[model samples]
Structure formats: C-alpha cells, structure tokens
Target chain A: MSDFIVGTCLFMCPEKERWMREREGLLHTFEVDEKTKHLKRPKADPSKIVKCFSRPAAGQLMPDTSELRPASVLLSTIRYLFTNVVTRVDYDWVMIYDFVFDRLRAIRQEVVIQRIRGPQSVQILEPIVRFHVYAGQRLCEKNISVFDTKINSQHLLECLKQLLVLYDELEEQSSMCNPNFEENIERLSIGNNRPQMEALYMLLHLGDSSALGRGISLPHKYRGKNVKLAMKISLAWFLKNYVRTLRLIQKLPLLLKFGVLSNLRLLRRDTFQIMSAAYNSKLLTFPGLKLQEILMYRDVEKLSADCKLFNLSFAYENVQFDARKFNKGLLLANPDMYFTVQTLQKYLPIILLQDDDAINDDSSS
Target chain B: MDSYIMQLRRAWLNQDGDVLADLLSLSHNHATNPQLGSDAAMTKAMEHLSAPFDDLVLHHIKVISSLNKDDALTSYAHQSAAIQSLAKILQLQKDENWMLPVMNSMCLDLRRLALKAEASKFGKNQKSGEVLEKCAECLMSCFRVCAADNRNSEDDTKRWGMLALVNQLWKVYFRINKLDLCKPLIRIIESSGLKDQFALAQKITYKFFMGRKAIFDSDYTAADEYLTYAFVRCHKESAKNKRLILTYLVPVKMLLGYMPKKSLLEKYNLLEFWELVEAVKRGNLRSLEEVMNKHEIFFISAGIYLIVEKLKLITYRNLFKKVYLVLNTHQIPVASLLAALEMHGVDDVDMDETECLVANLIYEGKIRGYISHQHKKLVISKQNPFPQLSSLNSN
Candidate 1:
C-alpha cells in the first residue's frame, strides 16, 4: 500500500494513460444508476477495482484547471464525492472515488461537469481541493515526514519535467477518459506508460510566463488537438533543462512550497547528524583528545540512563573554574588554565610516578 | 626619652607582656601618684610608651586573632592596657569584634572629645557628611585590623562579621566612591576562603552585567528577556560551570537578532553541528551536552550520544532505542544510521535490517509509537490512533 501511494505520487498523468483509464473504470462503478430510478442502490464489483485504490488515501492531490473546463468539471465532481461526500463509504469505494477524482483533475474535464451541473456545484469543488490539500498536509506532518533525496541529481530534473507533462496530458485527455452518455460501449487501455514529459514542460512555460511578468501566449499552432500536443512538446523542453526543471517543480507552488519542507522533518536532524559525524572524524584524527560520539535519544529518561553507564575513564573528565574580574582582558591571561588543570589531573600523576623511581636511583648513586 | 623608647621596643620584641604592662602602668601611675608623679617622668614614660606601645599592641592583637582556636589570654590582655593605649589599638582595629567591649569604653571618651572638637571647629548645623565620614573612617580602620588578624578566626563567624563591616563600608563608600581603600579588605577575605566567596561576588557581578545601560536603552525585548533570565541564573551553582555555558551561550547571544532569517538559521544549524563535532572530538560530553541542552537541540544531543557510544566510550542499550526512534522519524539516512551504529560496535548486525529498524524508530518517535525491545527485535509499533491492525499489518 505504501509502495503504491509512493508510486502514484511519482507518476505523471496523461502520459500514463493506462493509470488514467484504470481510474475511469474505478469511477464507472460509482456512477449513479439511471435505471434504478433513484430508488435502488448499485452493486460494487470488488474484484474489478485496483487493490491500491481500495482505501481512501486521506490527503489526495488536486490541482486548479481553469482553462480546461471539461477536465476541471470531472475533477471537481470526484473531488466533491470523495472529500466532501462524507458517507460511510468502504475503503474500496473511496479508492475508486479518488481514482476517478484524480483522473478527472489530471485530464482537465471539469468544464463538461460544470456545464452539466451548472456553476454552483463546480464552484464548490474549488474549496474541496483547497481544503483537502490542507487536511492532508496536517495529517502527514502529525506523523513521520521524510523526503527522498536518493534520486541522482541528474534524474531529478527529468522527474520534475515529467510530472508537469503528466499534469497537461490529464487536461487534454479528459473526454476520452471520461464516461460519455452518447457512447454505446468502449474499453480504454489503462495500464500502458506514455512519455508525458512534454506536457509538463508546457505547464512549466505557462506557469513561468505569469511569474516572469510575461502575459500568457498560446502558440499559433496550439489550437484544439494541436494545443495539447504543443503543451507536451513544451513540457519536453522543460524536462531537458535542469535549472528550469527545479523552477518547473517550484512552479507547482501547491506541492513544492515551504510547507513541503515540513514533510521533511527528518531531513533537518539527519543533515546535522551527518555533518557532525564527518567533522568529528576529521577532528578526532587531528591530534590530542579522543572524544566519544554522543547519541541524544528522544526520551530524556533513557538518555539519562545511558549517561549513567558512561565510562569516566574512557570519556575524559574536564574541570572548570571561573575567575571574574570586571576589568578588561582578564580572561585572556589564564584562558587555558582549566584545560591545563584537567589535563594535568589526568596525565601528570602517571608521569610523576615514572619519575619517582628514577629520582630514588639517582639519590642512591 | 630615646633610651626609654629603646627599652620598650626591646621588651616588646622579647614578648615580655608583663614588662610592657609595667611600663604602661608606670606612665598612668606617674600621672596620679603625687609623691612619685613628676612632669619629667610622666612626659618621658608617655612619649616612650605611646609610639612603641601602639605598634606592639596592634602586632600582638593581630598575632592572637590569627590563631585558629580561641586562646585563654585574649580577654585578659585587653583589660590590662591603659585606656589611651587601648583606645589607639581599638580605634585602629575598628573591624575587630573581640575588642568591641573594650573598644566601646575607649570610644565613648574619644567620641565625646571628638564631638566637642567638631562643634568648636565646624560650628552648629553642619551637614554631618564630615562627621559620618569620620565615623566610617574609624569603622573601616577597625575592620582592617580584624581582617588582617582573620587567620585565627573561625571561617564562618569571621566571614559574617567581615560581611557586616564591608556592607557598612560599602554603603558609605558608594556615597564617596573611595572603593580603592577596600581593596586590601577584599583581598583578605579572598585569601581566607575563596570558594565561599563566589556567592558574594556573583550577586555583585550579576548586577553589573545586567544593569548595563545599552541593553536597557535599545529596548530589544528578546535581548531583555534572555539577558535578564541569564542574569538571574548567572549566580546559580551551575553558572560556575563557565566554560560549558559560554560555548553555547556566546553563539546563542550573537544569533539572537539574526535567528529570524532563514539563511541565518541555516548557518547557525551548521555552526552548531560543527561545534558539537568539535566537542565530541575533545571527548568532553559535559561540554557537548551542555551546548545541546542549552539550545534544546535534542536531535544533535542524540546524535552525539550515538557517536560516543560507537567510539566505545559509552554503551548503547537503553538509549539507542529512543534515539533511533527519533532519528528514524526524521527520515534520517540508513547510511547515517549504519555509520552511527557501527561506531558503537554494533557492526556485526545485518545492515539492511538495522537500517529498517532505525528508520521505523525515527518515524515512531514522530508518530508517538512504542520503540522498545520485544523478543530481542526492536519493535516500532504505532500508537492507538492508527488502529492495532494497521500496525500489525505494517509489522
């Protein structure tokens, strides 16, 4: 289940049409029955649905698609049902709901849903996306948060560009993936992979345009079908550029903001610990003291208990003295006095013992 | 007269208390004895005794007071001296408590004569600063004798008496700013028992450190709160742990204004980590922990503890579980975990399993789970919110 959620997070839509089609199949099961006359409930087929989508992922991702009206409508409807519906829906039903909701958002099909439901229902979907993002962020932060920095630096750029392309492809392919009243029967492939990098590049260029203070310009060739493909090509350009790739990721302001950093709670401590260790290793080899490493366990009581077992001999003991004089430069005169005293206390006795026998022999001679 | 003075000095050097006493008695006796009293004899004896007797009495009193235990003859010797000689010694050693009763008698007559002289000299309704100044001078002279002779005085009683005298002098001196005169007195107290003097010094030092006008002038609220808080704790026993506190506090004080900046925070974090590493290399956990706790950098503290344990300077039994849990929750790297664990001689364990356990533990600290030893495997079970089955399934 964890792997699947992570995998879904990593996938870019439109290019991954099979994932979108699978989402449609899941959504089809949740559609209101026409023949039932609003009287009887429709039966849900458990086996046909993806196991990964069987449970409701608490904080699902939703995006704004103002220009892609049809895709936005479908997204908004699924968003309402999953996030706002508030039924005692089983996990399988909820997963199916997310699959459809996310697919609709990805394909930009909200316009058709808006025209179908009119403005009021579609307007409500906007808040649902906003609210769920907040809710998910809160939930995730309350638990352990980790950021995977394992991906090679080179691949990082490509990953970001692909994500943007996936966003645009979802907007373009909404109708083909969405259930239509006029279609007699159709089976859409929902398990094949497509290179969705270009569409993401277009999203980056589009997002960056406003950020850079450039007015939005739709290319002359980007009309209808050509528009979606043009978006794909632009996303590919974004994927190819490493510097802009980060910017593209940065452009997805919703997911990649400072708030995203909160998800990387461990990153802060881990970074500290690693750097500390590296520095200590260099220091320990440099000269005199052989200082021990310190592990600060989270539990205070446990840390205290561990401290009790610390060997006083192995861990060097240092004595401190404070001589206060209000005048200037008093500290510099005997600055190393405490260090000298502690070191002397530690090693001087042994040296003294070694000299004692020699001194006695010289006196006898 | 010179021959008589030389004779008195010889007697004092010989410690012939009786001979010195006879000479003092003879002077007063000649003052009243009508038959034996003569102007020439009285003047000769007073001149001879006055100068040598004053030095001799003061020196003997000092020697006596320096004795660690009470001597049987201390009270007897004070009574035998003529009031003139006694007055000179008592007035000079104003801080001495042992001479209080005898000094009081001499001071009565001397004070009366001084009051009469002052009335005649300064006229009526003088502001009395001069008179108070004279009294303070007398009081300070007495305290010096007592302090110089303090070696014999018991530590506690001597300290209390000295504190009372110094307090009196301090009040008077603050009005006049003649603090330099008290330098010898302060040194005397320092020599007797320096360790016991910190509380006294701390009270004054804190006032000096906090009462600086700059902090009050700028009105930086955080600086005010922090500096004030520090000033209060500055006198604590732990405050005597200066080296440990300063390592963290110096940096903390510098960064107080700069901390709100993200770039500054990043730099501070790096600096703090480097400092901890330096402390670790020095093999001084107290210094390391002091910095860590003062800053409330629990993760750094835990990291250092792990490092110490790995170095064979400490063991990693009870604490490893908890620290591992915290770091794990932070999604600290597996390689980092492996490195930390290996430093503690836990290198024999399977790296893969250990990494998973550590990762789970970090997550567990965040999730508020139980990361404890159960059946010899480190378990990271989530708390009640996630449902028992979910945890069981994860396991």
Candidate 2:
C-alpha cells in the first residue's frame, strides 16, 4: 500500500507518464490509456465479433403459428423416441444413443424451426439434457475404449444452452401475459428435473465462469442441497485446490459423481502437471497410491502407465517427478473410468432415471 | 388534456425531440382525467395527431392518465405501448437524430415505470427483475433500429445513439444479473466504427460499464485501462460517480500491484478496502477473512467478492516473500513457509496444499525461480526473484 507501489501502476497519472518519458523509457512504454482505446477497432483479432448479428429482415414468408406443428405433438414424439429407443433395452446403448441422438436433434431442430417457447419447450429440453448425461455415461462405461464417444458430452452442453434460452424467454412471456403462465412440468408426467440439470451443469462445466455464476447467484433458500454441494465441488475445482477437489468428489452422490467422472482426464492432467512441480525431483518418489486415490483411478498400475504417458517416470509404484521431464504437449492424461463394467450396468437405469440414492443424500461438507 | 394534445401535436409536427421528451416523460405530470383513454376520448385525441406518431402521443397520454390513477400495472402497459410506437417512429425517420432525445427519454422513463410497477403489488407473482428484463427488450427494439441504421451518413446516423442505448441496456442487464447478454452488445459496439464519435457523456458511461465487465472477465489490463479512463475524465464534481468507479478500480489496481492510497479511500469514503489492503500487506489471512466477513454485504453487493478472493494468491506471495526476507536465503524451507501461513491463520493448510500454492505462484510469474522438492526448499533466481506484480504487465 505504499505510494511508490500505487505510483507504479497509476496509469492515469500525468506525473508518471512525464517521468517515464524523461527517463527515455522507449522500449517499455505503458499502454496508451487514450479515451479512444475502447473506441478503436481491434487491429488484429476480428474473431471476437459475433457473425450472427446480421439478422434477417421479416418478410411475407414469415410463417404464422397456426400452420406449424404444436409443441405438444413434438414433445410427445421426443418422449416416445426416448422411451422406445434409449431406455427400452439396456445393451447396445452406444447404438441406441446414435439412433436416439439423431431423432432428438431433428426434434429439437423442429422446435427451433417452429419457434416453440412455451412450457412445452421446457418439457422437451429438460429430458434431452438428462438424456445426454445418461447416454454419455453409458458410452463412457462401454466395454470398448473409444475416446470419441466418451467426449461426446458437448451435446449435453448444447442442450443445456438451449434450455437456458427457453427459460429466459418463458420468463419474459410469463410477464408479457398475465394469468395463463403455466410454469408447470407435471401435466405430461415429467417432473421438473431442473435440480438434476443444475447438478449436471456444475459437474460438466466445473470451474467455468458461467456455471460458477449460476451457483453464486442462487441464495441458499432457493437452491437444493444437491445444488449447494455441486457448487462447492465446482468452486474447489475452480481454485485448482486439487486436494479439496479430491476430497469433495468422494462425498458426491453417483449422479453428481458423474460430473467428477466427466472431468477425470482434466483432473488427472491438472494433478500430474502440478505434482510434477510440487514433488519435482530426480529421486524423490511421490506415493503412487495417493495419486491413484486422489484421482480416483481404478488402480495404481493404470496410474503408473499414465505417468509414463505424460512423460513422468514411475519407479516401482511411486512417481518420480522431474519438472524438466514433464511433457506439456499432451493436455489430457489417458482416459480412465471411475466404475467397473458390472457397477455401471447395475447403476445405468438408476443414473438414467435420476433415482440415484444421492438425490436424498445430505453428505456433510 | 387539451394543452397536452396541443404540445404533442406541435412536437410531433415539428419533430422537436426536447418537446417530445417532456410530453412523454414519466414524471411530466400529465394529470388528466382517466376518461381520456375511453373509446370516445381516444378517438377525439386521435383526430389531431398524425398516423404512427398519433399512436405514440396517444399512448403516452394514456400512460400518464393511468399513473395519475395510481394503477401502475396499467400505466406500465400503456408506457410499453408508447415505447413500441416510438420504436416504429424511430425506424420511420430517416438519417436524422433529432428524435434521439425522445428515444432516450422514453427508454429511460420506460425503465423507471417498469421498476415502479415491479415494486407494486401487481408484480407479486413475477420473478425479480422480469419487468426490467422485458423493459430491456423494449429498449432493444430501439437499439436494433439504431444499430442497423448503418447505411446513413455519419452526421445523420442514428447509430450515434447506440452507446446511450447500450448503456441503458447494460444497466438493466446488470440489474437483472443477465450479464451474458451484454457481451453481444459490447461486441457490436467495439466492432462498430462509431466508437469515438459518440458524445463525451455517453462514451464515459460506456467505458465505465465496459471496465466493470472486463473485471468480471478477469482481464485486468483492459479493466485498468477502461476504468481509469472513466475515473479520470469523469466530471470533477461527480464524487458519487468517482466513488462508484473506485469500487471496481480499487480491486483491479490492487490485483495489478498498485495499492490505492489510504487518503484516496478516505476521501471517497471507501475505507472498507483499507482493512483489506492492510491484511494483504501484512499477509494476515485471518484478518483478511475478518474484514471480508465484516463487509460481506458491501463486497457481494458490489460484485467484487470473487475478485477479492483472487487476492489470496497475492497474499500468499506476500507471505512467502516475508519468510524469504527474514530467512535471507535462496532456499527457504517449505515447512517454514507452511508455518508462516499457519502463524497468519491459514487453517487446514498442509505441506501438499502449500506446495500447490507455491506452484501456482511460480506458474503465475509472481516468483522467478522454482520449487526444489528434493531440497524441501524454494529455489530462487538470486536476481529479482519476487518481481513486483505491477511491473509484470507495464508493457
């Protein structure tokens, strides 16, 4: 808090600029805090500008609501597809996912093309987001090791985005119209799984600013215990407090655990990179068991294999961390599962139905 | 009511923005009989004004009459209708900003009435900020017409009005906590060519909000640049405005290693930060937590809680530097640093987590050298190992 410290970054100070110029500081000049700095166009990077701002004008071809398919019919069609395709048979989930995914995409496209923003759009998107998480975990637990299908959780992110847009529009519409606002999810038998969606959002986007904002914006009275825990785990994740992240992930219910499971590669990669520096040595061995435990790998052998994969050395069972030997080329460590094939099979329906006993879980912080 | 119609006709006919602003203002005291909105009276009033503009004038009159009747919901509806007509008229007028004053007034009044209506019992079932959110959409209607009027000559472009609209929209967006929407509008403005040409007041307003947004994005360089512009060039007499700007600027400056003067905080009555500055300098984590909890409402309401939490990294740097200074060696033990943190009340911290902290500091370039795990010590550069955080970004 010294004046010299304050003077060092006093960007607006006339005296500082004059003093720097007098010192002939030509090479390390301060950024010009010109009034027009923001006004000036970005000289090099144009990608920051959104391309969709060039909106189309309304024309006679703009369709009326009467001619389009009702949101109810579209909602039912998606529901039918989900029931018959996704959950009808447990095996071949990988193929069922492709079929259900194609059908769901077309249905959502139909909703967008038809401009559906009623409570029905809410009904349709609520299930679709959950479907992605359930189906994604199912793919992760597949007997085959396909990184491509396992990383297909982007679709869940997309649906979550779609649901956020629908919720905003629905809010505006409810205010625009006085009494008929049915903010209900029960008429069609799909209860508001909004709490589950929030949990998924926190898990999937753990440490993301938008996700963190969603968590912080909610008062404790408004959010459920599940949401509160999800927020805490994500906050720990954000801070790169890997130790706490490891500890908190142990307490999460399985549904929320899928979030940690979703972020496993990132968790492992981050842990290894930091540990390479923290435990950096040519001879000292950071325990392989501790790394396996914190990262939730199935076993230490797999953990050791990943250490080699990331250019770190594994000695016997302990990891020898040399900062120079750490590889920065690979961003993610090898993919690993938190569940065995049998455990995932037993829990697939439970996760899909969101019937994870974790829903009632009130684990202490 | 008769004089109201006369002035409305004159303003609409002559296209006088100032006159129209008063005639449509929410506080303009157009206290007329409620019967003016009845079918027969609306027809009589409509006979005098022209098409399109007639709807605008008539709706404003209806809005005022409803306000007089103490029926805010009805007043808000009529004001919304009035803004809808105003947007059509703004689009209809080609290549002139003579009507911009009215646009500004109507949009501002539209927000006032919306907030008033939201505060009333009629909004009991509505979610907080919904009315204001809808009001932002109404403002967007004007915004689209103005932003899309890019084909006009610079002297006559309605695009000049964009900053004012954007400033209002930013206010509503921040109020409703839908900051995500402000990004596109910011993109349009920053990407637009009319950046410097807006009136000075509007430019100041734009920079002030943009600076706050940058803080949220953690782009401190941009935050410092934009916010310093707003704080310096902001009107000399506007102490309240300067204090508002300082609320954000202080944290950004601190993060960049430029601590604000205590007198400056005292002058602005922002000494809530004085305790924080002291805690950070003394490397007192417990006192830092106490100051934060004592002013928790202030910090959270100002939306700087998370940014303040980020200062903990800086606190750790300061704390470790203290240990290094006392020990006077390049190879200070990690356990010594952990004990220092524990002495300063960093509860539940351990060697591994402390190492994680040290790793983050080095990674962030607060420290020059690296951690030597085999030696159980931090390896220093033997040069300017702990570089001043501010000098790290001067270029």
Candidate 3:
C-alpha cells in the first residue's frame, strides 16, 4: 500500500491520462453504484507545490514531452517532496504527521504486503524505504521546536540516534542484497550523503560523550571499506586530538609555548597522528575534501592557545617569555624548525624577559 | 699685510705667475708660523692669498698655501678657490696619475660649496649660480675622463670616486632646483655601463631624487616603484635618510593603495601622518580636516596636501566595510547603505551617489560585486569584498 502511494505521488502527473482511462473503464463496468457516489478525490493546490525535483531528475526530465522516464518514480517523488515542501520549518508539524502516519508506520505495511505477495525478494526496496523514513524523521526533528522559539538539542540527538540505527539496518540490508552494495552506493551518493552526516556531526558539536562515541562507532563499523566512513572517522579523530592538544597547550609553561625543539617533539607527534588519520581516510589526497583551510584554522587556534597560556602564566606567576631565547633554543635544537615557528610568531608578541642591562652585559661579554 | 696686498695686486696686474707664486708662498710660510697663528695682521695677509687666481699653477699654489688658514677667508670663498684650482689643474693635464685624486677632491669641494651655498642665504646671486654651473660642468668632464680611462674604470676607488662625483652633481642640481640639468649627466652614466656599479647608498640617493621628481610631475606609478625600491633597499642604520625618503614616499605609497603603519611612521618621526592614516581608515573627514588644519605648514612643505586629500576615496572604500558587516549578507539595500554612509559623515548621499560609489569600487576591483539599480540594492560577492584590505596587516 505504501509503494502504491509512493507510485501514485511520483506518477500522478505523467500517468494521469492512462490512469483516468483505466478508471473510466472500471466505472463503466460498475455502472454507477451508490457507494461510489460518495467517494473523495485528492485536490491539488498550485501554491503549495514547489518545484523541488533533485538535479538528476530535473535535468533528465523534459517538460511537455516524455522523452525520458525516471527509473524509480516512487523514489523521485519522495525525494522531491522531502527536499522541498516537507522540509520547510513552517510545515514541521505536517511533516511530523506524515512521518508518523504515512512514512514510518506505513512503509512497514508495504514491506509486509510485498512479503505476502510471494517468496520474492524485497531487499532492494527495503534500504531505500528505510532511508526515506530516516531522512523524513531527521528533517522533522530538525525543524520542529519544543518551545516557541528554541529547538531542543536532546530531541535532535534522539533523531540522530534513530538515524544511526536506520543507517546500520540499511547497511546490513544492502550487504545482504548485494556484496558490493556499499561501494556502489558510496560512489553514487558521495556528493549527497556525506554533507548530511557532516551537518549532523557539526550541529551536535560531536563533543558530547554519547554523540562522539556514536559518531566514532558508526564509522568504525565500515572501517577501510567506505571512503565516506573513513572521512568521518578521520574528522572524529581530528576533533578529539584537537581538544587534547588545546588542553595540553594550556598547561604548558611560557617557555614551551614558543614551541621550541623540546615542545615541537610533542607537537610533531600530535601532528603526525592527525595527518596519519587524514591519510588513512584518503582525505589528504581527496580532491573534494579541501581540508587545508581547516588544518590552517587548527594551527592558528593552537598558536592562539599557546599565546593565551603564555599570557595567563605571565599574569599569575609574573614570569616573562623571551622570543629571542625561544628562537635561539629552537635553533640550537634544530634549525629547520625555525621557519614555521617564525611564521606562527608573526601574530604573537615577542615578549622580552631580561632587563636591558643584563642583555648589554651578556652581549658585551 | 699692506706690503703683501700690494705685491699680490702688482702680480695680478702684471699677469706674472712667478711673482704671484712667490708672494703666495711667502704668505703661506708666515701663515703657518705658530707665533702668528692668531695674529690679526697674519690673518689679513693670508686673506690676500686666498682669492681666486687666474693662472692654473699659481691658483694651485695659492690654494695649497691657504689650505690651513682658519680665519683667513670664509669657507665658501676657500672652497670656491680650491674648486677653481682643481679645475685648472685638470685642464693643465701635466700628470695623468694625479687626475683621479684631483678630480676626487674637486668633486668633494664642489659638493661642500654647493651644500654651503644652499644652507646660507648669501650664494643665490648669478655669479654664485654661474660658478656652481661651472663646477657641475667640470665634474661631468672628470667623469668622462675617468670613465674613458679603462685602467681607472676597473679601479674600485676611482669608480667610486667618479660615482660620488655624479651623486654630488645631482645634489647640486637639486639644490639649485635645476634637476633638468642632470639629465645629460645621468644619460652619460647610464650609457657608460657604470649604472649597476653604483653602491647601495648612491643608488638610493639617485632613485630618491628621481622619485621626488616623478612625484612632482604627477607620474605616481613611476614614483611608487622608484620610492618603494629606495625605501626597501635603504640602509637600516641610516635613520635620517630613511626619514627623508619617507617624507616623499609616504604619500606615494598612499596613492599606490598602501597605508603606512603608524608604528613605522612613528619610528621615522612622521607622527603627523598618524591622523591622516586613521582618518582614511575610518573615513573620518572631520578628523582629516583637523589634521590638515593643524599641520597645514607640514603638508604644504611636504607637497602632499593634494595627495592626502584625494585619500577620501579610500576612506569611502573603508566605510563600505562597515556596511558589509552590518548587512551581514551579499545583498544590501541601497537605502540602508546610503543611511550608513550619511551616518559616517558622507553628508546628503543619495541612492545614485551610493550606486556610483559602488560602481567605482567594482571598477577599481577593490570590491568584487555588482550594483542592482533596478532593485535599489547592492549585491556584493561575499567571498571577496574589498580584497585590498584583506592582506593588510591590521594594527
């Protein structure tokens, strides 16, 4: 029944003439029954219909002429409605109602109905249906507000949890249906699905214990097999290492904050770990993932954090940081390390610790 | 002293080098005697020997005789006599080996006399100008002679001496405000294949003069290139010369879309420019007016009043940054932008004027955006509005 509804929503316009002809034939066969006189008809409002066809369908479809046809009309219809009319904040309740009555519960009915028809396989349709249901639920949760103006993060987290569950189930079904299902779908959906997960991760900050653990766990399940999953795992690792690095930098002494030779050993260790994760995820070489800006942002944040630590140490202990000594130490330890530290120091202050007399005496000696 | 003056006048009337040389040499012997070092009569006798001479060797004798006369003659008169003797010695050509040293000292004395004349108000007469012009001509001839001498051209000392002579010629021209007179000499230097052999300091001075000339002629592009090169290559230890370079360089840099940093300006003691820099950044016309009124003499003397006043366009460009941040979107309503402009002291600005400003900014490639006159809106590109300000180091 849900497949029929999906089919109707997708093919409602293109198949309208043939459906009317068939209905006319059936009506002629029934010969004007009293029960049929009270039947309700679906109404179309032009203002409510926004042209929200996905790019593939919109580009392939020819208006006023049927030159090409969609492969899965039902999926196309649901995709259009899901992206356009149903995703609006003003229609959050309507979307929720549709999720509860038409999508979540009714999709199961279609599955059962397909099962009852024969011993035929419903595996191919199961993941697609589950994906639609999860997408609708996530959208409804994102747009819906518990209060007048604010959204509850807890509710969004719950939606994320459900989406994760559905994602796992779909993965299982897809694998059961086809051995290369994940790879094939990943190639086709790389541009579409990754942003959705990233948006979810960003919205939750992925810093909470439950969200971060779930984020890490879901990607681990597809370890080394999926590019998108590897990217997510890499991002999770980057965020984890970034927070740890920030905390470590904050506790560092004013002298070490300059990232001299001894300090750079630890910094290099952390950088290598992050970079290895990025490399393993193929994000280092991935053209679509431009992480250079993000890496630069991390470097800037690390430098600023070091500066803040230096300032804090100065304020509390009355100890000063000498940039020249720090640079000398860097040079003594290794000359190659000076270039990057010098560049980073441009935005930081060159704090003077020793008195002018002391410096003069030292230089003269 | 009276007998010496009589003998010098008789020798001059007789046109006799032997008599003049004898009298000058006798005065030199008495002038160096420690017993008469401060004697008024001895000083008066020395003054008679320091006058400009007609004979080349005799003038040489007189200059050599009065070289140590402290109170004998004014420095201008002494330097004039020395340059005259050097020019005469160069013309005589008795010894080729002495040419380089003679020319070097002549160039040094010419520079001293030119600078002294410039400093004092006593040498603005036609006679003084004619004498300086002759010194310039003599310096040019020495440069040609030294440059033509292949043996001396490769000698670092002689090469540097000749280069110094050229630099002094430029200074004389600058002091006389006849920079045009140095064009032929500069051409000679360029064609002589010695242009690249100039030391860094000499290069800086030459380029600075060229840049100043470009600025006066309103050729800002050439001026910017020359001045920026000079400023960048100037010796870090020479603070006074750096300040002089910045006096003309700051305004040229402003025209080239670079604002001098306040710290840099202050380091050079150009603190008066701080207000202009601030007013241009904030588009504060009133503060700019106040700065102009306070430093009216400075601006006029620096010859940058007009250039500084033209910075109002950049002021407008900066004012647009506030509008960009306030609207917080690519598309800004023209009316709101106009209101912001008016609030920022751009009085009575209307939509057309605002759109024109936007058009000019887009045309200048400062802001990457378009103005939609039909919709009465300014649609700026969010990625890079006002790209010129992005790379600048903010204080």
Q: Which has the greatest DockQ? A: 2
Candidate 3 collision pairs: none
**Model 1 alpha-carbon drift over 4 Å, by segment:** A1-365, B1-338, B343-371, B374-395
Candidate 1 vs candidate 2: the lDDT winner is 2
lDDT of 3 by residue, A8-51 (tens): 23341344433443355422211223444445432323222212
Kindly list the per-residue Cα lDDT of model 1 for residues A316-365, writing each as its tens digit.
23211111211222111110111122232232222211211122111111
Q: What is the TM-score of chain B alone in each candidate?
A: 0.24, 0.94, 0.66
What DockQ values do the models have? 0.00, 0.13, 0.00
Q: For candidate 1, give the lDDT.
A: 0.33
Model 1 TM-score?
A: 0.18
Ranking by TM-score: 2, 3, 1
Of 2 and 3, which scores higher on DockQ? 2
RMSD of 2: 18.2
Instruction: Give the C-alpha miss distance for residue B6 in model 2, angstroms.
Output: 3.1
TM-scores for chain A over all candidates: 0.25, 0.70, 0.28
